[model samples]
Target: MLGHPWAATELGPLPTWDPAVRAATDLVLASPVPMALTLGDELLLLYNDAYAELIGDKHPAALGRPAAEVFGEVWSMPGVGDVIEHAYRTGEPFLEKEATLPIHRRADVAEQSVFTRGSCAVRDSAGRVVGVLTVAAEITQVTRQLQSLGDFAAALAGTLTLDDVARVALRYALTVFDADRVSFAVDEGGGGWRMVRRVRGELMDEADERLPPLWRRGPADWPAPAVEAARRGGASYVDDGEPLRGIAVDRHDQKVRALAAVPLRAAAVRGGITVGHHDPHSWSAADRALLAASAELIGQAAERARRFETQHGTAQLLQRSMLPEHLPDLPRLRIAARYDPGVDGNAAGGDFYDAFQLPTGELGIVLGDVAGHDVQAAARMGQVRAALRALALNDPRPDQVLAGLDRLVTSLGAEGATHELFVTVVFGVIDADRSQVTLASAGHPAPLVRRCAPDGQARATYVDVPAGAPLGLGSRPVTRTVPFHPGDTLLLFSDGVVERRQQGLDRGLATLAEAVAGAHSGDPRALCAAATAAVPGATEDDVAVLAVEHALRPSRSASMEVPAEPTAPSRVRHWLTGQLTEWQVPETVVGAAVLCTSELTTNALLHAGTAARVEIDLSPERLLVSVADSGTRGTVTRARTDTLSSRGRGLGLIEDLTDAWGTDPTVRGSTVWFEILLPAG
Candidate 1:
């Protein structure tokens, strides 16, 4: 006896079922709720007499039909059948999902079956999903009500003007609830309904209805200020609005009958709403809920709109302040970068880019975000960005720079600021000679790099440099670096570009990579603009971008011989790997010597450095790994220890990891330095 209007007689004879099926069908028919039976998978509907009452005029013929035949064209749209299938497949009831039911003047369907918040699937006796038990309590009332409220919410979201929400919400209540008219006013200090909207009879203008500073002791009003203040305090009422005391425009006041009022404030200020009707009528619970929900939605939407504006302003200002006026004069390279907030108002929501010259003359570039929207979020972003710039001067290492930025954010505390606030940053320093670019980052978006053939005859090949996370909110983050050849282009960006809601960071990054894969341009700025433009602008978050192309130039570059290390191959390998990665070397070459470096360095340390100091130096031509000890003599002979193992055997392994090995007697100790000309391929 499902709530379906159709009856068994209208459905005609159902197909003959097995004896067990007939008994089960009988039991279902005896139940209190409206019930239905399916002829196989066709979902043949069966309605008991109690179910027939809800349909009023339409029944009998409506029985034994697929839902598609019952609802007609609405079934052709998306999601309806899928929802029903999901319910049947899982044996749970589908409840209160907003769908389009064919019986209404609207498209939204609000099912009222007894599932929790979503669909409750119905199951067979054997625990397999067989059918769906659906009960629609015909909340057309609630549906229309909430729809009007949603409309009001939409209007509020588009506006910054204060009165628009009240006007829209009032109008919604009138139309959705089928009331004659609902009008509202606000009190701008002593002025009543300072901004107003209302519906009236054919000859009357409800918006024009006004009263002076009249005070009445009745249920509806005292004065413009008191009534409006009460309303703004989130107070509301239902009343037979009539003048029982002091008033102006006494005639209309007498004509007005009932009223309802609620607070107009949605985001943190006092606003008021009032609805008027000429006839006395009782409102249903659904109507009242719609009234309240609409007002709330309107208020919240207004706040969201205002916040979007603020963040948008902040994003624009930050971009203007952060991006360089033009690309720097990087030798042999044409560098350009483009940045767009994507959407005008959402620009305030956290992405930023910067390229600036540090006092040391190193080119410092950063791309980052603070991860939220609003004026406060933007302010925090500004603080972190400025702090990052200052901190970069102290260490300038990509990891260290981001660490400092993280510490900066942790130190910022407001009594009510959202926690888990962190920043992600990628920072890089272009070498003075422009031979190589030293890059590092905390958790952040990675930079896109493309190296042009030094011969200038082939197309530029792209390289990827992925750094650690953005600034803030992590105890420890992975450190990363990549070497750059002359004429290499490194394109940096923020998360706003190519990002989608709830899809995570990887998708955006993948899309970005694809955008750059086939480009042939050397102008970083033009390329950047075109690349950024290809990303979807529907993003709610802001985006920041900066691109740098490293080009070689003639410049003096030198590294002093001031280093030491253990001589074991394993130890040497570990130390060299750490130092080289920190200094940003090629990943492939570092891997080749990884094992060899450890064995050679350990051998030198065991037989040297104990009596003096150790020295290790890395240059473009040769990697000099040495160990000096205070001992008067250094030897290349195999050790005579109890066990003649390679631990103290000799410097024989040095010849293995490197091309040659030697020793030197310095002023303080005998120094042994090995040299290996790095291979060229």
Candidate 2:
């Protein structure tokens, strides 16, 4: 600058260099660090060799030029020019830490450089501010690295799944290190690993065979450096030569020049992450350290996700196995059942349902929930369900069944088999013959009965059954019989259906009743589904539902008694035909009914040797004929037809001609009944 031609043309001659300018120049030239002196009103630029190198390609031409013209790209940056002007004007030094300057040092290429800028005002002998002497120490690499790690940490904290961890790790690694490609691999235990790779922000398809294998071998098969680093749970960098061969580099189009692998260690599993670059570059200690830290975070997240999934799966399986595989085919009833686990932990709660046949020909339906949500509660639920099924075989009463279950639960608690476990259950027995349902509640919500009024509008109301303390609380439960008329439905559900976090149980129950009344169909399955749908939000507890609907009853014609003798079949058949004719039963169905009545009466007299009574029922859709006898061994069983034989076709003939036939034991003997559909008019 002292002998440059531009200095003579732009600012005339040098001022024999003033005292302040000369002193600043001497000080800047003597310093080994990057320094620059801007002198006079024009702020002419003078920079040391180190400062010239910091400016990149703008060295020689920038000498002897004005500060604004030389550093024009960053002169207007926030507080840049103002700080320099303040020091020059007020003679008060200023220091700014980590100031950003956007510089175009390379032609057509702009870059942001972070620096610590310190400016001191040079004074004349008279103490007047002369020029600003500024020093800049560039820290762009260190600042950018820290910012990248901060971003990675922020994104890593919100990840909940293994895939989420992989995606976030790859995205941040590429951005932070400015790498061309990044790939993450998780060890699949037994010497196998699954890998996901992304190149320049594009994820490669797993099915693409062109992509090299990620887990064909274990870590021991890799190069010594990578294997040793993994053994020590650290990070290692492999250059673009022999070490690259041990790693998969099947990106045929782009040759990998460098690679760095970091071991991800967690309590459950261990994995590896690798970042690649196309240019052969050395990785600094800070870069390797950042990669290691990111790998550790990912490993921790993967372990948590794995543990949750495993627990959720096991809980779901256990809960499902405890529920009924299918509802029983109860006479004159349609049944539907459902179960849903809580949403908070995705773990199964103690809610369960069961439908089984009692010895008395009644269908027993049970819905219950244990107090807690865990393996122990689920196990206890299974034990209670099994006990209830066994008890129902001997005792068909709802109150008796619940009483036994309560005792069983108390026994379990007393034996240290359970810990403070309380249970709520509603046991019900449906008697289709009597058109009634008896239910017993053990601290459970009352069952709901839905029916259509004469006006064809649906109405839903809860049974006013007396309450009892939950099982394990030692309260005797009372059984209440509700008039389950034809076309009425009985709905039993867990509290999860009507219990919301923000609402009381009463309000939820009211909402459920309203939903049931507004249902589009009266079918049991449809009603149960609608009730579950009516829940306000995500359920905090498991839900179990059981619905039973009694269909319309058939009209009855008076029953006839016949003497138990050789002539009883003919007598019963004559009486049945006459009754059917008076009831306007179709001719085609009447003939079949008479024949079935004769066959059933003859069989009963021959098998039990007792008197028999015949009854007929007619509906707009069908006809029912029942024959009761004072025989203990009388059971309706269809005989297999032998094409060559003719004598064993009585029961076979009846089965072929009728729609359905079954036998139910009476107090004295058994009643064999057969139904035939009436012909359409």
Which structure among the candidates has the greatest TM-score? 2
lDDT score at residue 175, model 1, on the 0-100 scale: 66
Task: Tell me the lDDT of model 1 at 628.
Answer: 49
Q: Candidate 2, residues 1-681: lDDT per residue as tens digits?
A: 567763464345666556766777788988898999877777878889889878878888888788888777578776887788778888888888978887677876778889988999887777777778899988898798788777777777776455567777877787778888777766656654556666773533322222122223344344433344445677778666434554555762146678888888787866777787887878888777777777777777778767765786577557666766656754577676767667643466798888877778878888998877887778888898889899888887888888888888889998976558889899998888888888889999998999989988999999987769998778688988878888888899999899888778888898999999987545565677678767687777877788887877434547888788898888887777887888788788888888878888887777666898887656555676778887544234445543222224666677688866655433356677777766666
My TM-score estimates for the predictions, one after another, are 0.36, 0.58
Residue pairs clashing, model 2: none
Query: Native-vs-model 1 lDDT?
Result: 0.52
Candidate 1 C-alpha lDDT tens digits along 105-211? 22345343221124344444555544455544444556655566666666666654333444455456656655554444433434333333445432222221111
Task: Candidate 2: list runs displaced more than 4 Å.
Answer: 1-39, 42-183, 195-260, 275-286, 304-321, 324-338, 417-419, 431-436, 448-460, 481-491, 514-533, 537-539, 546-681
lDDT of each prediction vs. the true structure?
0.52, 0.74
Q: For residue 346, what is the lDDT in candidate 1?
A: 31
Off by over 4 Å in 1: 1-344, 413-419, 453-466, 473-483, 502-507, 535-537, 551-681
